[model samples]
Target: MIIATGATGTLNGATVDHLLQRVPAARLGASVRDPARARHLADRGVRVRRGSYEDPVALRRSFADAEQVLLVSSSDIGADVVAQHRTAIDAAAAVGARRILYTSTCGAGFETPYPPLAIHAATEQHLAASGVAWTALRNGFYGDLGQLLGPWQETGTIAKPADGPFSWVDRRDAAEAAAAILAGDAAFDGPVDLVPSSPVTLADFAAAASELSGRHIERVVVDDEDWVAGEMANGTPEGAARFTLSMFQATRGGHFAHADPTLVQLLGREPRSIADQLADQNIG
Candidate 1:
């Protein structure tokens, strides 16, 4: 049986749905935070079990009678991600899962500049030490959703602190990749970066978006001092704005620019380009 965590989340839900088509409903289980909320999945014939990152018991119970478990990372901020992942990993191992697939962040090596990535990198290291067959999908940024500068995108101006480019992957593609890995078609024993074949700078992205939307979008770069000032002037909370700006600054340093060939090979075709993805969404 294939047991999947984070079944309620967008990407995870999509992954489970794809796998459900390939595997029978009896062979599929979803670990959700609330069984009541998973009525939709249950209606589709998935076995639903209650679980959460904060509750290891729930996870242990959820992973029971499962062969393969996909451990989707938690989205909690300010908490110890490593600790949360450890809880899920321990539970999966206890249930004797034959293999584990973890959704992780891209650029998981020690030299990565992004500090948030450290949590995932550490979790991957721990998973390796757990003596289980493991595969890690070190994912890139999601391209379907716009950033916090979303409102700015509508106004034909993107004000960000980043100075460089980012190569983002469509969440749909990431979900499909997860399904393929869970199907046991791709054989690997370690972590792999899930990113596109190419990247586009933030400026280029904004410009292309403007062209697609028939707007004259322009990049308004903000420095450290001005970033806070602009945030306040724009009615943003000081603390939240500072954190968001810092993430952009990291991106400017090529934090999200990692490129890999694995995505194309796994999908057996070229991953969607920025323009192609936007066009599909009718954003252009």
Candidate 2:
């Protein structure tokens, strides 16, 4: 049997949806924080269990009788995400899981300026020391560039801090690749980067938007402090604004510039490009 954490969320939910097509519902389990939200899955005959990284006993029980578990990383930005992951990893090991696949970031390392990158790195280290087989799904940066672009359709301008390139990837493609890995016969040990076929800078993204919408979208580079202040003025919390600003700092440091083909090889085709994603989303 296979169990997936965060099964009600977008990425893992998509993975579970794909898994249902390849595996029987009896062989599948969903570990969600709120089982009430996952009633649709249960209605389809999936086993739903309440699990939380904060509760080790519940997590252990959720993983019972499972051969493999997909540990989707938490979205809590202010919490001690490393400790939460450690609790889940220990619980999976205690349940005698054959393998644990963790969703990690592409530039998760000690030197990255992004705070979550360090948390992911620490979790990977803990997983290595655990007495269970592990695979780190190094997913690329999400392709929700519109959030940073700030109403580009009406403003006709994309403003951000001066940054470097990033290999943006759609969550849909990442979900499909993760489903393939989880349901495949072969084993993938250690870190597997799921990135796009190529990387694109912010200017390149603006150009793509301009071409897709047939509108002149100007790319404006602003100071980091000015960007943060602007975000706060727009009603974003101060902490959240600062955290979002760090991503550009990390990108300027060349953390997310590299492209990897692991996702392409897993999917048997090239991953979607930034231009295609923008065009599909109809972002001006």
Instruction: Tell me, by TM-score, which candidate is best.
Output: 2
Q: On residues 133-195, what C-alpha lDDT tens digit does candidate 1 reach at each position?
A: 998988777743465446555577777675666667888888888887788565777888888
RMSD of each: 2.2, 1.4
Candidate 2 lDDT trough over 10 residues, lowest sum: 143-152
Question: Clash totals for all models, in order?
Answer: 1, 0
Per-candidate TM equals 0.91, 0.96
After superposition, candidate 2 runs with Cα above 4 Å error: none
- Indicate which candidate wins on lDDT: 2
- In model 1, which regions exceed 4 Å deviation? 109-113, 280-284
Clashes of 2: 0
Give the Cα lDDT of each candidate: 0.81, 0.90
